[model samples]
Target: MLSIEPLNQADIPVTASLHRDNLRLGLFPKLGRHFLGLYQQSFASSPYGIALVARDEGTVVGALFGTTSNAEHYRWVTRNFGSKLALAGCSAMLTRPQVALDFACTRAGRYAKGIARHVGLTPSGSSGPKAASRPVSVLSHIVTDVNARRRGVGRRLIQGFASHATLLGIHRALLVTEEGGLGTPFFERLGCRLVGQHKSQDGATLREYRLIFDEEGAYEDRDGGRVAYTVVRAYPKRLGPASTRPQRP
Candidate 1:
């Protein structure tokens, strides 16, 4: 049967490969291996992030990657980076409106951060508009292999995280996905409702969604066992057991 678990040292290559291949299929950075490696390093090492993968027997076939973030966790990116983006856009307009067009997408990407960061512009002693705050659980990202689509692999991987979050007693689980893409409908059907919509730093529009979870849910793999994949990640020794072989076809 297919099983899901957190990604660790052994699964790096699998996560990296799936991430790279997905990028090639139109995800992000769209860069070659060099940049992909850089991304892998960050993703693998980030304590705030987690990657869950699905295996059929011993073969790695699907994955779901996510980052853990609190409400204030967006400070660095939104305030500083996004403010720079807004400034750059304004400067572009003052000099060349055409150049400003280039930053239109950039500003939109930073809009959420712009909103978040501006709360700090006022002096600390002065009563200013408070930064937005609310109860939040760990944030995450998710992906599945294209070849393995529609057989419930994505569901398996995502549900794995849901179970993990529930066990951790995290009441809310949040994630972002392209609003109109394959993931949109998928998440919606799974009971995650849209919470917000925004543009990306690269001008792509995205939707944020969340779900209230109970730890009692069970995650089952529909793949029935090992799923085939062009690439695979290694198992985290700290996790329970290594994937096992499926019955012969």
Candidate 2:
């Protein structure tokens, strides 16, 4: 039987390995060790973080990191992930300078924009959902084990995460993926609609998809079964009061 559970500390190494082995995002495989851990920790340590893992016969087959508020999430990440990234970057520089340099250069623009948003130079809605101030949920670093791809692993993982968001009163869950990538169709099939498109710093096009739970109370797949997964939320200890967004199942 497959089960969804809150990600625990012991699961990190295996889940990180899964991300390295399966996810094909640019620079992910190159700095998989450091970057995956950083992303997971950024979410895990945040007050708004919602981390989950899917287990089959005691092994992790899929995992995801989510947050109810990007603004608060980014603030925590900026304050906490900086030193760790610098240290990791320094280590990569010594062994693989070219790869390290390329990764750093590519991320320069994103870091600048993040800073602009934090400092208020990039106004809300300037970059659409990326800068939206309204209550929003971010789905980040979602991946399924290559060996377990088509057995409903990804769907269960997403449904589990979305259920958690619904419990927290967040209606909009969004993620960005490379255009024409496997994730595009996967997310679309789960009822996430394409909302916008933008170019990455390296000029690759990316599409943003949003699953509005309010509009999609429960989705009917082509087979006519309602998508469903059960998630048990640990008591939420948010950094602030919960969002005022209307709750919907």
Candidate 3:
């Protein structure tokens, strides 16, 4: 049986467990308790952050979690991080270690130099002066137990997330995930169109996509706020699916 519900404390253990198995299978390291604890906290914090679980029989097989920052959240997040901050230098390196070592070093240097010219590291030329006035939502997490994959659990989770966006009156939602995975196909099926792709040494690719609802809500309209997009990336490097003719199950 499959069930969809808002996530609560009780579901954290199961959600984290599923998250663990899916990524570690691809040579990813197991997350320590501290990270897992933080993960749960962040997942629950997003104003529109929501979770849904799919169960096969009595076992939890999949989960979807995401967030949408409202006007208030956009104000808070931007005020602190302010456009073009320097603190993320280490994270940029950690996430893209596979690039040419020299290139990575140069990019880091460039990232630092470019900061003064850019506000909030945002694509918009303006980021600071328009903080609290805008509303944004960030969809942050999604995972499925490996053993239960290929069974539409992922697709259903996407639907659940869309439903949340619909409820929030958000006409659109954003999330980034590993490219060409089960999750990709699932999102595409649900009207989530691919917006862009970013790649790095670990063979990790961040694919950003947006899902727009029929008539519920819309994204943040603040002056300098941003669109919060959930990022679901944690997979082992592997040969992509072959071009072999499709075989019906």
Each prediction's TM-score against the native?
A: 0.57, 0.76, 0.57
Q: How well does candidate 2 score on lDDT at residue 135?
A: 56
lDDT of 1 by residue, 1-249 (tens): 787866666666776677667643222323333334334444445444456778878667776655544433344334334444345435435665544565455554555544645457533222322322223554455656777778788777766765565455453567777756777787776666567999865567889876544311112123443233211111112122323535333
| CA lDDT of each prediction against the hidden true structure | 0.53, 0.70, 0.53
Best by the TM-score measure: 2
Off by over 4 Å in 1: 23-28, 37-44, 71-135, 215-249
How well does candidate 1 match the true structure in TM-score terms? 0.57
lDDT of 2 by residue, 155-232 (tens): 777767767887876756789998978898877666566779999766879998765554333232333343533211
Considering only N, C-alpha and C atoms within 3 Å, which residue pairs clash in candidate 2? none
The order of the candidates by TM-score, greatest first, is: 2, 3, 1
What lDDT does candidate 3 reach at residue 249?
21
User: Which candidate wins on lDDT?
Assistant: 2
By lDDT, rank the candidates, best first: 2, 3, 1
| Candidate 1, run of 10 with poorest lDDT | 230-239
Q: How many residue pairs of model 1 clash at the backbone?
A: 13
